[model samples]
Target: MTTLFSTMPSAVAPAPAADQAVQDSSPSLPEMLIAWSARDEALTARSARLPGVAYWLREVAAARTEHERALVRVVNQHGWPSVDLVGDEAATAALRILLHGQDHAFLLRCRDLIAAAVEDGACSQVHLAYVVDWCLVRLAQPQLYATAINPALGRPYPVADPDGLDTRRNEMCLPPLAQELARHQTRRLAS
Candidate 1:
């Protein structure tokens, strides 16, 4: 099914070890975003196979650890990068990294930052909704909207109020949950 993972670069080569030094040299916001996007793409591709294979799960876990470390380094070097500072695509890539991140505290901090960015018109409401709902799902709380997906199931997870989910989603400029699920199902069946 198509997901944020679907937008990742499909054929980008893995960065060489020496590239770590280049990354450490304080890359521009767009460069950092591109690097994170590649890492996120690799992690997502690995994670898709994790359910059926132990090896894939290990790879996904390892990639997650590496991704987390890289994100921490980026945040430490520069506060939450925004669309205004970078560009729409780059900031969206950075947001995707935060969405998939394992650090709860860091994700919460990013949520706050993204919320502010949205208020400042530096981010889209649709993206904010995804991040907010994802964080909620991660926290074991009921999501505001069913934007978070169950990768294994290839569909959205259960929501607190299914009947009103579309109303909430509509407010954020997202389509109804049924439409989203159908789209995912269609993509899966096609593949």
Candidate 2:
């Protein structure tokens, strides 16, 4: 149903021809991030009420596939698009996509980039913690920090030190694990 961009703010302008040219030349990080966000939002909304809708699911999957391809192109052109290159917001959004992506190798590359970005004070530790936890979980290793939440279970994934999770989370500007877990539990109960 509803079009994804129907409610988009009027202030956001359509991409210009020159911007399209740049994207055609190579994957534009900011543009791709924006597209990913729109598609992700659409998928989230539709999936919540129409879980069995194959068409919507296919559309979302196609969008994700496009994002993955664009990510590869961006990486090929430049190791990773830093905040300096794509701006802080776009870089953060790009990192979010990679964190949730299925390609472990690509995620690892993005993780290294995020680490460097954090060192340069270009990105936040909060973002880095998510990717780190996701990578650890993907590798079947315990997460050092409990940043990755298990959506289905409505809780944080397995952590190396549950007791120390909140300490590490606090260092990364994240809320305490107990507090987050409680919030998730509350939401589950409500649902």
Candidate 3:
């Protein structure tokens, strides 16, 4: 019964207010974004279904949270849906980091920003549903979009309005719950 909110982030300290100035030669935000997300994805993909996979996932989650803390610091300096967040890859990375986030407030902020980004054709509309669902799950309420998964349970968190789930998922451009469940099963089997 470990909820995502309860299980994530063994501890995520707020990013320090100031750090070494970005070297003019430093990698751009888009590159940084891709690297950050790729690091986590590689870890998760590699750990799939191995013994102590949960341990690996938790480790990844904790490390990812620290990354998010850095993201927050960077974005806060500019803004969410940042002008510097050029390209879909960078934007999508931001969304993925926020999706696994423990901070409900930040998730909501990113949710709204992402929705606006979607309307502006800068971000995927699908991300809006997920950030919203993450917020709901963090509150211990049923998620509307069925995007928040409880990794411990290997299932989505409780979904509200079950009868209309597919409709909502479709509107957000997500696959049907059944389809997603099947996909999850396949991933587990393949793992």
lDDT of 2 by residue, 85-137 (tens): 77777777677667656788888888888788889987788888988899999
**Which rank order by lDDT, best down to worst?**
1, 3, 2
| lDDT of each candidate versus the true structure | 0.71, 0.70, 0.71
Of candidate 1, the 10-residue stretch with the lowest lDDT total is: 15-24
For 1-191, candidate 1 gives per-residue lDDT tens digits of: 56555465644355322125324334465775666677657655655635575554654565556656666666666666677767778777777767766888888887887788889988788778988888889878889888888866987766888888889999999998889989988866754
Please give each candidate's TM-score: 0.77, 0.76, 0.74
Error of 3 at 51 (Å): 4.7
Mind giving the per-residue lDDT tens digits that candidate 3 earns over 1-191?
Answer: 57765656633233322233333324566666666677667666656645576866776776677767867765666566433354677777777767766777777877787777777866776878888888888888999988877767778999999999999999989999989988887876776
On a 0 to 100 scale, what is the lDDT of residue 117 in model 3? 74
Best candidate (score: TM-score): 1
Model 3 CA deviation exceeding 4 Å by range: 1-27, 45-62, 81-84
RMSD of 2: 5.9
> What is the lDDT for 188 in model 1?
65
